[model samples]
Target chain A: MAETVLSSGEKIFILHGIDADFRNDGRRRCEYRSMEIETKLMPQTHGSARLHIGNTDILVGIKVELDIPHADKPNEGKLEFFVDCSATATPAFEGKGGDDLATEISNVLIAAYQTRNAFDLKTLCILPHKKCWKIYVDVLILQCGGNLFDAVGIAVKAALNSTEIPKITAATLDGGEPDIELSDDCIQLDTSNYPIIITLCKIGDNYIVDPTLEEEVCSTSSIVMSVLPNGKISSVVKLGCGSIQFNTFTKMLQMGEIIGLKLNKTLMDVLKEENQFGRQRRIFGFLK
Target chain B: MPVDQRRINGPEVSVPYHIYSDFNKKSDKVKHDFSKRSDKRIDSEIRKIFLKTGIVSQAKGSAYIEMGNTKVVCSVFDPRELSNKNGYCMQGEIYCEFKFAPFSCQKRKIHQQNAEEKQYSLILQRALEPAVCLHEFPNFQVDVYVMVLDNAGSSLAAAIMAASTALANAGVPMFGLVTASTIGIYGNHYLMDPTDTEEAICNTQPDNEDDFNHGIITLASLPQHNQISEVFLIGSIDTNTIKQATEILTAANKDICPVLQQCLVKTIMKLHNEKK
Candidate 1:
């Protein structure tokens, strides 16, 4: 999260700009900032992606391990989200200062992926009740300009798209205990149903998507929604310390649904196009 | 040598006995009768509520509420100077702690707050922040603690209502009183103020691909101001359900406002009589 102290004049200027459907960066109300996405950059992780939107930057890495399934959910695998706000993102985030924001973002992600339609955990299950694959999605906030949730959401989906889960070659029950063997073959996950988040910041009488840091300071409240590719909303959370009329809240939900579907379609297309290049594509690290 | 000696510890891999019991296999899986609940309440009918104020003497203000089986007690303390190492702020802050007793739920809760409890605390703080007049108590912080003695369903909504009353009881200035309600949506049925069982069922993924909406929504609103303070929705639900759920929840909030106002009035009357 980025923090800024604005004077009365500056606040009014930004508010008026939003009211007239023009943001500080000249983008329309619903238009998002152009994002740059790179996948499979880190060799240590099973899947890795970096996304940059305006000044906000997020890096997502996914690690998969074999573990026992939960007692209640024996047939399903687990998806755990852990967010680490690096000190480089902001000085205030140093030394456990960002725990609250980290928890909130991770909780939202967990709720977004909770539904089976969004991301099926059954596909990750190796053996029912005995063994399963635990996919750990770790998000690192390298920089925070504004709209951290949406940036992280995009990065996570891209990373999951590039993930290659090692396929099981053989399995058998030996002496009432399950024994499994792994092959060199790997299978890609079905990321088509993955959900992406859309954040709408209510400024003045209008709502804007992907507000910058200065614009975020002028807003009263914002809504963060996770929408699947099928246009179904998985979860919605209202953020900030302000309230809005019930009428405006419903309007925001509808707007978010439309924007989320467009963003999901665009992101999937981008990932698919990138995948077509295969391993021949040059990897882009932090360097230009 | 690394073990903690302060308290007793259970086995490393202790499984609940109910998991092994055969009694729950068949009977528990029986599809619930959507027509009538176990308590014979209709789908749209909420459970009876009992609201009271000034329950705790040690705190500045307190309130206790019960909705069917869920019981929650909330207390608010006087504003204290901000203790964190932050710069001067224009608006005061509110610190909310939401806790559940070990025996509050069917499964025993731990001493420390879990992830779900932490999320609930954050939501509770956000829901109450908009209703409070923080500018009046600038440079200070008000602490609110909510304890769930028994959780049957809609505990978060219950906590929100109780905390709002506690804040009002402490004479915190506000634009309007805050009221909250929860709903469980399953396909076409909207179960207002769902019980623990119904809430679980609604939150799960649909067994068949009927494309029906399902989810749980918890909303807090300021009735007099015509504003929604917080909305926490979980599960895959469509926009239509959200539109309908909000309307129903808004009406539910309005209905409970009068009950809260009456309780507050009674508390004030007793205080005035005692002063005489």
Candidate 2:
């Protein structure tokens, strides 16, 4: 939890603006700031993407390794998420200061992708109980303006879209052991049903989406909802140290669903349009 | 002269022996009858709850609760100076530890905290943070520990209820009492305080592709204030079910408030009799 000390006057000003449905920025109550996404930035990893929402910057890299499947879930592969909060983001994240927030974010991402509709883990399985591909998703938080959950979710989906899993040429059982072969060809993973998270911050009697760093300090509580592309919510978790009335909670959920669906469509269109360029897309890196 | 290092030191993998018993075969992947549960309870009926406070003599406050086969015990320690001084703070903090006995579940649990337990601890803290008045003891910390002796299902919900009662028994200042409930949704059926088998079935992917919405939701709310302290939902559920589940859970939470109040009243009466 990064703290930005604000005078009582400053807090009142922000709260009043939100109560009137006008944010400090020129966005509406349900509007999000402009976002920029770039994929395939790291050549060494199987997939990589960088996402920027205002000053909040996140980098996601994915790697695949051959491994055995779990005993109970032998038919499905594994997806592990690790989040690293860089000290450069804020001094508060130094050492183990960010472990709590990092674990919370990673666990939420895992829950969002746990369902079959959101992500079909069976696709990553190579063998029934012997061999499978384990996908490791590492998220690096380079900066945190606000709305870290949504930014991380969108970046993860983009990185998964660009991932290329090498094809298996042949497989055979050699006595007790199994033999497998690989080819140069690679196949892309399916990311159509992936979910995008939308966070709604409750300020005063009204709830707003995508609160800025300063505005985050003014809100009482916020809810994070991960909505699938098909308009179904995968998971929801209430954050912040505040209580919410029953009616207000339901209203926030409804608002979150609407905003999440819109965000998903926009992100998919952007990713599809980028795919059309097919390696010809310009690499912007960190530069503007 | 060298030992056989190639051969594994132990079996490649060890599994529980109960999986081979006849009991497991009888109910393997059977399409659950939504009308009546295994315990003969209706879909919306929760199991009988037995709640008591002041179970631990040494702790400042303690409570133990049982909902059918699930048993949870919570203890709250006194407020002490913050161990890790991170600058000056105006409000107090809470440290929560949630654990399960090795034999609590069907499978054995290790002594070290697992990822699932860690997440539960964090969720417990969030659920209780708003209900407890932390400003009363600034720059100090209150430690709350919850251990599940038997986890049939809905362990987190049971822990939340017990911990709140323990906090109150400790005589700590608080805004209002908190209670929690869990609901398992399978298709259109909403099973209140589901059992272990029911929870597993609901959590699994829907067999027929026609139905895709199923999962669990645990909600903790402050009934006196008419506000929800925490709402945690998992699995893929549509918005309509979410709305229904929230309503049902809120009512369920309110129903348990009177029971807790009765328990607290009984405890006070016993103390008064001893003092006289």
For residues A1-288, write the lDDT of model 1, one tens digit per residue.
556878989999998888888878899899999999999999999999999999899999999999988876778998899999989999879897888899989989998988887888888888888889999999999999999999999999999999999999876778878899998989999998888988999988889999889888888789989998888888998899999899999999999999999899999899989989999899988885
Assign candidate 1 its CAPRI class.
medium
Look at candidate 2 and give me any clashing residue pairs.
none
lDDT of each: 0.89, 0.89
Kindly give the stretch of ten consecutive residues in candidate 1 chain B with the minimal lDDT sum. B1-10
Each candidate's DockQ score against the native complex?
0.57, 0.49
- Please give, for residues A55-157, the per-residue lDDT of candidate 2 as tens digits: 8999999999999888667778999999998888999899988888888898899889988888888998888788889999999999999889999999999
Per candidate, the number of residue pairs that clash is 0, 0
**Model 2 misplaced stretches (Cα beyond 4 Å):** B1-14, B17-27, B208-211
Q: For residues B1-276, could you state the per-residue lDDT of candidate 1 as single tens digits?
A: 012334646655545566557446635544667888888898878888899998999999999999999999999999999865777877999999999988898678766787888899999999999999999989899999999999999999999999999999999888778899999988788999998888888887666563657789999999988899999999888887898899999989998899889989999999899999
Candidate 1 reaches a DockQ of: 0.57
What is the per-residue lDDT of model 2 for residues B117-198, given as tens digits with 9 covering 90 to 100? 8789989998999999999988888999999999999999999999999999999899988899999987888999989888
Angstrom error of the Cα, residue B137, model 1: value is 0.2
Candidate 2, residue A21: the lDDT equals 79
